[model samples]
Structure formats: structure tokens, C-alpha cells
Target: MIFYNGDLWGPMREETNSWFSRIYSARYAACTAEEGHRNLVLTMAMDLSSKTGKELELPIDVNDLMKGL
Candidate 1:
């Protein structure tokens, strides 16, 4: 299922968090922002791990992965 990992923290940051961008499957894909620029997979993992108290191994879509930039 689509899950939110966590947000990114920094001294000089524009945004507070990012989403799990790349996922292994559609169902497992993350629910990202509308603009799509703020969503970051790494940050998501960190967030989910901290908040939910569980480790997240994101599943990335193979087809989408190939098409990703």
C-alpha cells in the first residue's frame, strides 16, 4: 500500500518533507504532492520509519523505474 515514510529536516530548507517517489508497484507507490517536485523517496523512508516505528522497504515499479529520470 502507499505509505508516507517521513519528512526531511535541515537548517536551510524550503520544504519540511518529501514523499516516496519511486515505488516497486502501483499499490505500493507513494501518495505524493500535487506539484510532484517535493516528493522524495529517501525522505519518505526516513519519515515513515520514525513516525510509524517500522522499517520501510519501498517497492519500485520496474517499468516506471526504466522510464524515470
Candidate 2:
């Protein structure tokens, strides 16, 4: 049940518990440790909005930023 970087999760909740049992599994399904780690480095390599060339735009409401907010 522990939360990892951003929306990542690892290890198991119990001996019989698989990753599919967790709520965040779907988000990290395609992201492996190596890939995620590499992407992490790439993400840190960029300055916020610097590589994008233009300012990032908000696609949704500020008050509704979160999944359940």
C-alpha cells in the first residue's frame, strides 16, 4: 500500500498479494523500474517548461486538479 515516486508502486502488500491488487498498478503497468528510472532522469534533466518552447497550459480547472478534488 506504500506510494512511490509520482504514481509508482512496488514490492508487495503481502505474500499472496500481486501488483494487480493495488490501486496504482494501472498507471505503472507499462513502466518498469529501469524505464521509470531512466525517464526520471530525463524528466530531471529538463527545466520546467524550458524544453517545451512555450508555457505549459492547464487543461483543466485548478480547483479540480486532483482525481477526486
Candidate 3:
């Protein structure tokens, strides 16, 4: 996921935390691409906090995806 701006930090954190909580019991993977400045840090934090979640780095360009869309 790509966050264009950091203004949504509060909401983003809450959402990610909620997601992590739900999947805490099961094995899951959080795959994120380097689309924005804050995405890496946020996803990394989530990955580290989750007991069963693994973080995957996707080599995708959000800008290119957006252009295709």
C-alpha cells in the first residue's frame, strides 16, 4: 500500500493496528511496496509487532500502477 501523504498517520496507524490485531492468531503476510515515504516504516512496524505476520517487499511502483489505471 502506498500512502501519498503523511497527514493520515493517525487513521493509518489505527487501521493497521486493527488489521494486525485481527490476524494476530494466524499466519499472514504483509506485502508492501516502496510507494511512499511513510509506507515502509509503517509496514515494517506492523510486521515487527505481529506475532505471525511476515513482511514482504514487493517490487512494484505505485506511480506506474496509477498511470496504468
Candidate 4:
């Protein structure tokens, strides 16, 4: 089964609370993202980072993207 390590951390902008575009992955794939581009992986990371005590969103549909893989 596919899963993600939810310990989301990032390099803070030199003392700022905001995270840079890189989210740490325990699986060591070293994922990266362009600024403001909400790719599926990043969306999952941000959802895991949330602490607002709300229900999570549904999983992203990567079927089409995965077809070529």
C-alpha cells in the first residue's frame, strides 16, 4: 500500500514561521515544488501540516498521472 510519512517540516526562511517550498520526507525521495504550485504531493503535505482540528480532504486522484508510470 502507498503511504506518506506525516512528519512535515521545512527550512524556515531564516527565522520566519513560513516554510520554504521543500517539505521533508522520511522516505528520502527529496521532493521539491515551485512556489505556489499546489501539486498533489504538496497538497498532501500541507494537509498533514494543518492543526485546525478539521476533517481531512479526500486523497488526490493520480490515476491518469500514474498510468504513464
Candidate 5:
């Protein structure tokens, strides 16, 4: 199980083509994009491990895993 406490405000904020971006820039901003990306990779890894009936050890450094993104 994974627990995430980071802010999702940035990713949840509605996208726009005009001044709304600037208007809510600071009000709706967080590190959710990066956190979501990491969670996606981890979820995939867990799914694959379960499908193969094998224990999954995350041997790779998280920073290294995130570098490609």
C-alpha cells in the first residue's frame, strides 16, 4: 500500500488558455505532477509483480527512476 500526502491542487486545477492560469497560479499549485508520475510507475511495478506472482523490490533509486520523466 502507498500513502501520498502531497498536494494535488496543481494537477486538479482546471486548465485554461487565458488569464486563469495567472489568476490561480499560486492559489492552486503543488508537486502533485511529480508525485503522480512516481505513483504511476510504482503502481505499474506492483501490478506486474502480482501478475508474475513474484515479490517486487524497488531496487532502483527513486531519483534515478524519476530522471527519465
Candidate 6:
């Protein structure tokens, strides 16, 4: 996705494969594009924390998605 004034922003990965199925498991099932998008954002946050060791908290629920809009 292109950059803009969006609430949930992160590096978007094409989910043509089961990238998160290992860690996220069943939660990755039946996910709307929106939910999968949210999972990717959280995954990015977690990855950043792992790389930087800066401990980041990411929400995985749609309730936190685009509430600003």
C-alpha cells in the first residue's frame, strides 16, 4: 500500500502464501483483507522489536483498526 494518513501503517506483504500461519495459527484463517492487513502490521511491529530489542506492543484486533476514521 501507498503511504498516507492512515491509522494502521506498516510494510505490506503479499499474503499469497501462509507466512503467518506458523505463529498466528488459526487466527489467520477466514481473515478478511482488512484483518490480514492488521496481522501484517502487528507482525511488522513484532519484527521491529525483535531486530531493535525495543519491545513494541501491537494490537491484533480489528477494534483498533481505523477507529480514527
> lDDT for each of the candidates?
0.44, 0.45, 0.52, 0.41, 0.56, 0.54
lDDT of 1 by residue, 1-69 (tens): 223465444542332222223332334324446334334545545655677676655654334333432
Q: Candidate 6, which segments miss by more than 4 Å at Cα?
A: 1-29, 59-69
State the weakest 10-residue window (summed lDDT) of model 3: 60-69
TM-score of 1: 0.29
Please name the candidate that would achieve the greatest lDDT relative to the true structure.
Answer: 5
Please give the lDDT score for candidate 3: 0.52
Better by lDDT, candidate 6 or 1: 6
Q: Candidate 3 vs candidate 6: which has greater lDDT?
A: 6
List the candidates ranked by lDDT, beginning with the highest. 5, 6, 3, 2, 1, 4
Question: Per-residue CA lDDT of candidate 3, range 1-69, in tens?
Answer: 345565435446776866677589665445433344457555545544464464434543545333433
8-61: candidate 6 lDDT, tens digit per residue? 234543443355554366553566778778777777666656667775445634
Clashes of each: 12, 0, 0, 0, 0, 0
Among residues 3 or more apart in sequence or in different chains, the pairs in candidate 2 whose N, CA or C atoms overlap within 3 Å are none
Q: For candidate 6, what is the lDDT?
A: 0.54
| lDDT (10s digit) by residue, model 2, range 29-53 | 4557777666644443333346445
How much is the lDDT of residue 18 in candidate 1?
24
Best of the two (4, 5) by TM-score:
5
The parts of candidate 2 lying over 4 Å away from their true place are 1-28, 48-69
RMSD of each: 14.9, 13.8, 14.8, 14.3, 11.0, 10.7
TM-score of each: 0.29, 0.29, 0.26, 0.20, 0.40, 0.41
Q: Top model by TM-score, which number?
A: 6
On the 0 to 100 scale, the lDDT of residue 52 in model 1 is: 65
Which of the predicted structures, 2 or 5, would earn the higher TM-score when compared with the native? 5
Candidate 3 colliding pairs: none
